[model samples]
Target: MNPPTPSKPSPPSSSSYSSPQTLLALINNILSIVLLSSLTIKSFTGRWQVIHSKLTSLGSSLSSLSSSPHWSENPLLQSLLPSLLSTLQRLSSLSDCCSISSFSGGKLLMQSDLDMASNSLSHSLHDLDLLLRSGVLHQSNAIVLSHPGPCSSKDELSFFIRDLFTRLQIGGIECKTKALESLLQLLSDDEKSASLVAKEGNVGYLIHLLDFNNYGQNSIREHATAALSVLASANDESRKCVFEEGGLGPLLRILETGSMVLKERASAAVEAITADPENAWAVSAYGGVAVLIEACRSGSLVTQTHAVGAIRNVANVEDIKNSLAEEGAVPVLIQVLGSGATSSAQEKAASCLAILASSGEYFRALIVQQRGLQRLMHSMQEVSNSDTLEPVLRAISSLSKLDPSARLLSSSTTFIIQLGEFVKHGNVVLQQISASLLASLSISDGNKRAIGGCMGSLVKLMESPKPVGLQESAAEALVSLLTVRSNRKELVRDEKSVMRLVQMLDPKNEAVYSKKFPVMVVAATVGGGSSHGCRKRLLAAGAHHHLQRLAEMKVAGAHKALQRLSGNRIINTILGRTWRE
Candidate 1:
């Protein structure tokens, strides 16, 4: 689609302000001229003479204002000047083509150049119309109509975007800028708009505008990059469009070379489009990781947030985790975690650490090397947001796998107590992570007593109907706590606790190994004759059948549990078996 070449009246106000009505009128005039030019170019008659005269007059007025002293001072007039000049240039081309056709007296315009200019003008005018009515402009207009999003409205929107893309292809900077703004507005959370824009081949337009290394205009580049991000963010198809159009290269360019604002915007887009693991790999291949790591190291909080988010997603690949740390992401992430970054930044930072930690002991040791555990634990105390806390807990859980780290964590009285409370009353995920941490920590002989003291909560967790993983974690912690004789004696004395342990052995639930281990641990404590009520509660809760079945399973823990139970005379009399048997 071609944009129209038509003269525009000079801005009425010397001041920077233009009322919404005047703005709308100016847009309408531009569209009207394009439409008229398209109709006039259909025939090579005197019609071109009338249109040329009107455009000539408009050109003179614009020239007069261009030399006026105050014209550059008014922002409104300043904006209008370029668009007016562009329109005049387009009109001048069309006028010359029309004169040739008229002199030859051809019934048809015969001049494809004139027809192409007129067609481009008509399309550009339509694009401007679409922008004006697109509801983005409505924010400035009081009596605005509602935005349309249904099927028909989307079709019309799709058509407008095609025209905008045409104008973009035709190389009018002013038209391209306006089209970028319109594209951004349409590409909201609306799926249809994104799909349409991608399907209509406008993704290339967005990528071209985002050519920050090539596009010298920072404002235009910023808008274009932002629009590209939005389009790519919508879904898989749109993201594929961006990647296929070679958007990743320019996005990385903006990240490395654009202004700070552009960097933040581009980083966010990188995060969105590279959401898929393969796409993330592509970004990493293109050396986006180093740029993002730099962003995390020195950029503003906003830039850090987006950069970290992108890193978090890209860190899905195991090799990338090492790459991130090798490039100095470990300390950067730890810094963001400790620096009191925004809740979102902290979440991403914590999550990135968690991903790295999940890769292996190397990353976990790295986190510990960076004082990551101390910082994470500290940040957990400062923030109450579940999202932030969840990742912190996950990283801590991963780190707890190392015996030295577990011992260190176990020694922190404050951290242990906080974790115990999380098991008791935190949300499901928090309960799960806390239980897992406590279970890991309980391996340290010194840590068992501290966890045993929180036996009441562990018992409650065993009885609660939570997700199977959480139940397993809680059960494991409970079993570890029972390894201490004092904890077993206290727990066995509580009939409810004994009954819960027996019920936990039912094996009907998932994670049967978790259930079996806890049962074996509890059974080991019971067989020692520490509590008189154990046999009665175990029989009362129908543990006999589950235990009998476990005994026949040939599992070592289950066998050991059965051997231990054999030593109880009351239990031996009931089952008619002994330890040696």
Candidate 2:
């Protein structure tokens, strides 16, 4: 942020005297005083020079104090807040009492006295913030906003707010030069106040203020951008307001026009809009997908996080998913999961992978083999926080949707067992969701003994005294494991397990089965892969004849089961070796 640079003071005003000649005379007297001081300094070589030097140094300190931030922790400076508040006769006094007419012919009036305006405004905001820290935020806010000080009006009230922000932008811009610090303070304020200024519709104003060549400083521009992040999430009505007001395009333009911070803020705003699923498609339609992907792939960590967040919000809906998926986001997100190890980046990549994986079978394979599952599991160890933990959740959720990703028994078992541990660690959400993923993995692939090892736990969960949600999730999990073509006979062989499942399917039992089996033939084939003797048991038990009838009818389950069975040369040859009776 640029500090306000000093320049030579202007000549005395013409109104100094009743006429121009008097002003000229006063100016001449001042010039003579300066000339005498120079001559006297020349006369006294060392002593006079030292005294002159000290006075000059004091003047410089005073000047810096006038415009520079109060540093020193000086009690006097700290006392200014309450002192100014007591002195302010009214809020209207915050402006110098000037008016400017807008192009729309609206009049904007300033209410505070010119001299104390900036100082008073700063103190007011500072004191209010202090009050809130003391825990009277709600009551204090109501009182302050209600104080119709001469500066108050719904329309005119905005001027003080704008003034406070502008001075904040300029004041901090002039010092350590980071107005972002102050802006973020406002941002971290409760959602209520952040929404107030954001909903007030100054987004376009803030965007315009972000010009790269602006005098105050880039840091000030950065602060404005920070403020925009809060505004973008102010409310749905407000987000649309920002969008319709053309704030969306200009805000996004910052992705290319501003610094890394600005880019992240702009990307974040786009994400905030996508949070409302209704606007998710609109974001894609408005060409934000490329911007989001560009940000996701190459932008800073902030941009990547927000970009991935936007993708996650949109991926839940169908058409929106195609839009995000089309922009080559899948490969980019996969790359983020690879190259970036930040918590947020990992989280987003996990979720995006889940969304894409669930879209179809090919996508499922794409996510699993394209190195998604491995990285997702790895991320669980890299970062902390609820958000970082979420991608694993989504990975599990998508696993439910996709079927399976790992082909090797070792890899699949490791991931499944790790997930079960997370579920057992006591997050019901994780438990239910993990159960769903385990179900998908078990049913989707040939890893049954692993499922069998957990069969007791799963079966017990199936009969647990949990809430309906847990019950439903447990049942779905069991179905996921049981849905594969091969598990049926083993589940049946236990007789007790089969009877339990049969009872689950029976209306006579208090418990309900979804009644929809994924595909019994698929289950049978999956069952066949579970053990050495299981396939022989099913065939010897007349399962092959039963399956042949299903194939004639073109049942999906039978088709898959036959395909798995057909792959075995011994089985094919033995079946072919048979002579018709």
Candidate 3:
């Protein structure tokens, strides 16, 4: 009866049944929305924050007024109160407009910040341009990587850093020379990004900076010269870019008056440009080799290093190879290895010697005489774990064409054989060079016979889908195998033999097949004229058909094959019969 007392007012109407806890939670949520909206609007629209700040200021003023009887009595303060409170109330209402989503709110604030940053970066970049154009040092120095003022944009900040470097370089002469410290900072990095900037024109500025007239003294030139050394490590294209911009003349001039560091950079710039085949003749045109030769003789390891790389690059010109070799480069290069120099210097010399060996037979004989065989073999023997791959590739390259036959059938020949096997052991570069070395080694009768011992393996290598150079080299070695009369039958007997020979002799392939055409001509007999055993056997294998195709039409390199095929009347009859069909 007591529990039924008043029946709790029939448990209240459903609409009016909300619990005190629920009501309290709803009030708290409403208050939370109000407060969160105020915070959010203030964060996103920075201008909205000004309103918040003014509201806070108005509150402080009201608090100040309450602190003094005179403040309340003051007419000025009295009038300001209504206006201040009215403005704050308006803002509070507006704040309520922004509280729906936290995620959207965050995105909104981020967009605003980015806008501020972009605008700031733009203005800053413009100011930086003005400073650079004015050639005013203090102004330029003021616009640094640091923010001198609130920035325009966040997105372009990094681009701004790059543009500053670009402006410092491309600006008028006064502006560029004024940016020495800046240029040094940018070029100081040898990384690819920094090198991309350098390759664009940094190397040119460095060479220009070291120009004796521009620097005004050897010491200034010397400092610029040192900066150039950092630049040299950037890229081979940068050197070419510098050269194309007319940098070699100034660099060569610096080589005469600059310090060892300067001498090296000048030589390096020279080397970079001349590394391109198109520039080798230009380098020879500019007296580059003579200057590089002097630097190569320098006691400074850096000077000797770049000098060697430069001279080798310049030697790519058939025009300059003899001159480079004659200018004491060969003897000095050979000497640099034994000079107890740094490995880099020795490597540079070894590289130059390798390039020289590619040009003249004299160098080939001389290198073998100088025990280049020993040094080259030693370098090849040790494949270090260094991940710096280029040096290793370069070492392998220098040894790839050493012509071990010229070195006698000593360990180098074994090394070439081992190298051929090694070609199978690695990536594209090693395999291609290994094949190239094998082709060079397999050129003589004995060498061809030696290579013939591995013919089945070479044939296997050729069949595998490998790099073009390796395939080309294997084909070339097979061509070299044709120099021996006894080997021609075996070459003709292989199923894919004629096709490989045709591929080798194809001009469309741009391969070195002109020399092999004569061998194919010699090996191809049509049963009409030559009674040689190999010719008879080759004709027996339908080599006459391949030879008749070459001899009749001069399809690719058939001029010599034409000569041999012309003697065979039966081959002509066979060709006529085939063509008529």
Best by TM-score: 1
lDDT of 3 by residue, 1-581 (tens): 11211111111222542343332233233333333445555334665454444334434433333444332222222223233223333334445444344434466665565455334433333433433332222222333343312343433333444444455543544444445555456455324434454433345556666656763655546555655544544666554556566766777766656666677667666666566677668766767677778877763776677777777667667768878767767777767766766676666666666666665567776766666655655655543322212233344454444555434432345565555455445455555565665556534455455545455345445544445455556555545555665556565566565455444433344444343433333433222233344443444444445555555554554555545544567655655565567
lDDT of model 1 at position 150: 53
Q: For model 3, what is the error of residue 241's alpha carbon versus the real structure, in angstroms, after optimal superposition?
A: 6.4
Model 3, residue 399: C-alpha shift (Å) = 12
Q: Write the per-residue lDDT of candidate 1 for residues 1-581, one digit (tens) a residue.
A: 54444564453442543443354345446535544554546445555555455454444443444344433332333344445435545654454455333355453554454555555444444443433333232222212122445555755565556555644554456656666666677776466677778887557667877764545677788888887877778788888888888898889878888888888888878888778777788766788888989988888878888888989998887667768878898998999987857789999999988988888888888989889989988987898998999999999888888888887888887788788778767888898888877776745555566656567667667656557676667777776666676777777677776666776677674434455655655565655545445555555556666776766865447766655555567765755543234
Instruction: Name the regions of candidate 3 deviating beyond 4 angstroms.
Output: 1-179, 189-219, 226-246, 276-282, 337-351, 360-407, 410-413, 416-420, 423-459, 469-581
TM-score of each: 0.68, 0.51, 0.45
RMSD of each: 11.3, 17.3, 22.9
What lDDT score is found at residue 207 in candidate 1? Answer: 80
359-476: candidate 2 lDDT, tens digit per residue? 7766666666666666666666565555656656666466444434433313555666656565555355666666666654533355544554444345445655454555556555
**Model 1 vs truth, CA RMSD:** 11.3
Ten-residue region with minimum lDDT total, candidate 1: 137-146
Position 31, candidate 1: lDDT: 39
Q: Of the candidates shown, which would achieve the greatest lDDT relative to the real structure?
A: 1
